[model samples]
Target: METVRTIDLLLDAFGRIPPLLADAVRGLDRAALLWRPEVDGRQGNSIGWLAWHLARQEDTQVAALVGGEEVWRAGGWHARSGVPYDEAAMGYGMTTDEVGRFDVTDGEVLIAYYDAVHARTVEVIARMSDADLARIVDRSWDPPVTAAVRLVSVVDDAAQHVGQAAYLRGLLGGPEAD
Candidate 1:
C-alpha cells in the first residue's frame, strides 16, 4: 500500500492486486485454468499460461539482478512444470501450440512458484541500499538499466500479465468457469 519511496513503489506496484489473483486461480479445475477464448479462429492466452509466464519472467529477472539461481530451477519447478524444456525458456516466443502444451494441472503449483519468486524478490530488495538500487545491472540500452528500473520493469510486466490472467478468468462463463 506504501508507494511513496522507490522500494515501496516497487512493492506497492507489484503487491497491488485488487483483482485477487488467487481467487482467479484457486479452486479452478484444469479446464477452467487453461481455457483460452477462441476469437476469429485465434486462441487467446489462458489464465494458467499468463501466471506461469509472469512467474518465469520475474524469477529470471530477479535472479539475474541478484546473481542467483532462478527459483524455477533451484526450487525444482522446471521438472514439475510440464512445459517443454529450454534452459532459458520463460514462455518468451512460445508458439500457440507451445502455449497450448503448457499442461500444469494444479493451480497450487503455479501459486507456490510465484510466491517463491515474490519472496526472493522482496528479500533482495529489502537488503538493497539506495546505491545498490542505483547500480547498473543491464547495459543493453543506450542508457543502462539500474536495479531500480529493472525491478520496476518486473513489476510492470507482472501487473500486465496477472491483469490479463484475471481478465481471462472473468471471461470464463457458462460451462467454462467450472
Candidate 2:
C-alpha cells in the first residue's frame, strides 16, 4: 500500500472541517449564535465567536505561510461584515471583554468567512512544494515553527472551535444543516 504524503493528509484534514463548521453554524438563531454562557464568573464563547475566531486564525496563519494577504482583508470580509480590519487581532489573546464585544450576530457572515478561509487554505497547500512545507515560518519558540507545524496548528484550532460551536448549538437546540 502506498503511504499517503503529508500534503495529502493535510488536504484531507482541512477538507473535513467545512461541513462540521457548517453544521455548527447552520440553523442557529441570533440568540443561539450570540449566547454567552457563564458559570462561576467565567464566560464561555458564543457559537458565532468560535466560528469567527477559527476563520480569522486560519486566515492569518495560512497567509503567513504563503507570504501573502489574509482572506479577511484581501477578500473584503471586514468591510462586508462591518467589522474593523485589525491585522494584529486574529482572535488570539482576546480578553474577556473583547470577546464579549464581538457582535457579529449573523451566522451567514460567520460561515461565509470560514468558507473563504478554507478555500484559501486549500489553494495555498495545493501550490506548495515539499520544500515549502519544511521551511521555517516562525522562530519565536525554542523549536522554530515550520510550515507543516503551522498548518497543523491551524487545523487543530479550527477543529476544537468547531466542536465547541457544535456543543453550543446542541445545547440551544439549533436545527441541523439542510
Candidate 3:
C-alpha cells in the first residue's frame, strides 16, 4: 500500500471542513444562524461560535507548537466572548455565559475570523518541514502534544463542528446547498 504523504492527509482533512461550514452559513438569516437549540438542552453554539471556536482552536494550535501568539488572543475576541486570557493571551475555554457576551451578531466578524484562520493555517503549514512535525510542544491541558497531532486535531475538530453547524442550520429550516 502506498503511504499517504503528510501534506496530502492534511489537505484532505482541511478540504472537508470549510464547505460544510459554508453550507451551514449559506441562506441563514442572522437570527437563525445565531439561534441556539432549546429542546435538545444543548449549550447551543451558534454558527458564529462554531466558526469562532474553530478559528481560535487553529490559532492556539499554531501558536502553541508553530510559534506566535494566537490571533484571537491578540485580537481580544476571546475576552469579547467572555473567555479569560492567559498572560500570553490563550483562552481557558470560558463558560457559555462568557461566550454569550461575544458580539456574534455581526456576520462579518465571524467570516473575518475564519478567513484569518485559513490564511494562518496555510502560512504555518507551508513553513513546516517534516522534522518540524515531530517536535513536541506543550499543550494548555493534560499532556504535551506533537505538532503533527495538533495539526490533525485542528482539521478534525473543524470538520466535526462544521457538520454540527450544518445539522443545526437544517433544524432551523434553512436552505442547504444541493
Q: Compared with the true structure, what per-residue lDDT tens digits does model 3 show for residues 1-178?
A: 9997786677667766655666667555567656776655646677766766776777777776666877775766545444333424322466766555444545555666666667778778777788888777756757677788888887888877777777777677623423
Which candidate comes out best when scored by TM-score? 2
TM-score of each: 0.89, 0.92, 0.76
**Model 2 score (lDDT):** 0.84
lDDT score, residue 128, model 3?
79
Worst 10 residues of 3 by lDDT: 83-92
- True-vs-predicted CA distance for residue 17, candidate 1, Å: 4.9
Model 3 spans > 4 angstroms off: 1-3, 40-43, 73-92, 139-144, 174-178
lDDT of 1: 0.81
Structure candidate 2, residue pairs in collision = none
Q: lDDT by residue for model 2 over 116-164, one digit each (tens)?
A: 9998899999888889999998899769988999899989999999999
Candidate-wise lDDT, in order:
0.81, 0.84, 0.66
Residue lDDT tens for model 1, 44-124? 888888888899999999999988999998888977766565657898888888888777848888887888888888888
In model 2, how many backbone clashes occur? 0
- Candidate 1 vs candidate 3: the TM-score winner is 1
lDDT winner, 1 or 2: 2
